[model samples]
Target: MLRTLWKHVAADLTLAAPLLRLHFHDCFVRGCDASVLLDSTANNTAEKDSPPDLTLGGFNVIDEIKTELEKACPGVVSCADIVALAARDSVSFQYKRLLWKVLLGRRDGTISRASEVIANLPPPYFNFTQLKQSFSSKGLTVHDLVVLSGAHTIGNSHCPSFDNRLYNFTGKGDQDPSLSPPYAAYLKTQCKSLSDDTTQLEMDPGSSLSFDNHYYKLLLQHEGLFESDAALLTHKTSLNEVKKMLISRNFFAEFGQSMRRMGNVQVLTGTEGEIRKKCSVVN
Candidate 1:
């Protein structure tokens, strides 16, 4: 069912990126319980409405898969596990290689507040120190930070995501000097203004579809699209991780290990939460 849905929902990086992104958002807040899938009610705003998640797609994909699973075996599959599997398959399909083993039996949470997203999710403008602090606070290592950032290898980021790097960088009428000058000029053509939220730029220029270490190669060239991606070069620990990732032959294995660890963050099992009938709403 996931394979059939993958073709219709994600022929390119558009759907694949959001599936991975939604998984990350779910894992970071409330431990991959699918709290990120909850819909906004009249009394509350959900995480999906958060600024970071405002552009996130693939919500319907999750719903579609959940519907299929319910029809096949009622009250057995969890929305959380569906997201985990979808994220894995999306990367696997794009990379043309298997990535991770997503554990099952995760339950869905009933709460998803927008404020938690702002507090938990790191912005693209965060520097190395800030990014490290954010990930470390969540019990993730510097290794996870670099490996997961590799997801950028197959996604398109809105112009506003990295607008500060292009114009008004450091609150001045100039660009981020750290960004490659040629690449910055090229980005200027694609993203005409900081307010141009409609334009989406590929994070990895030549190989946006493959899930390899080319993102690291691009970072080495200062071609990383986000400030956080460039920030990897500034810190000693992350810099070493990047260099190691670049040289490591076991790319998929290492990524799979990290991905599984990330999926295990604050999970709900053994009657902690419920298996919702609908992924977008609590039963």
Candidate 2:
């Protein structure tokens, strides 16, 4: 019945679209630990990898929902479990469909660092080799790499996150000619204003809140926003697999399975971690 309770909690949390989007952004960048949601502390500033103060607007929404759940179910549920369940459910609800199973019993991680965020999360401009290496360090495979990239379907990137991809098209240094002309034009327009608000670039223009196969379709159309995303179509090891997934339903099904595997990687459980009272600022 834990799985059923988990699903109900997830569905309830999905009512907040903003939190759902933030969850996707965090998980896609650094697995599904909610570490990206942690705030910075003076003590952790000197750490090797400190996470940014992204100002998770949805955090309060999550807390409110969790409080309600606790009163209804007592201590039967955990905050960490709620975060994970909500994340998966948000994707499914936003897309209007369900795909994979999310295992429960994951404990919240007590430690969060900014330097680690910089080192672990893939930059928007990384090449296929760099992407493969980054995921490999986390013990994920090529298939996991492509499937997780699908998370881009729901989140948005700031101009600072993807500005280099535009105005710099050199195949060698910063420009990636693999980005389609229409796609590049869209990014240029999106980032034209120098305001921080201008950095808001949607991953899937077709369906921003959905989690279907739109990401694969975007890659096929050469409309992927990031250099790393476009690189999938040009890289030898990943190109064919990406193409196959885009055109075949069976391939998309396997891609979903791969995502379930990626989500469950090396998670801390039992008494291994702590649930922070604040997701942004670490305790």
Top lDDT hit:
1
Model 2 alpha-carbon drift over 4 Å, by segment:
1-33, 45-57, 94-97, 169-175, 193-199, 275-283
Best by TM-score: 1
Q: List the candidates' TM-scores in order.
A: 0.96, 0.77
**lDDT for each of the candidates?**
0.86, 0.62
The C-alpha stretches of model 1 lying farther than 4 A from their native spots are: 9-13, 95-97
Per-prediction tally of clashes: 0, 15
lDDT of 2 by residue, 104-221 (tens): 6655565555656566667777888898998887777887778767767765666766666665556433545677877777677668733444457677885765555678888888
Instruction: Encode model 1's per-residue lDDT on 97-131: one tens digit a residue.
Output: 55677777788888899989989888999999998
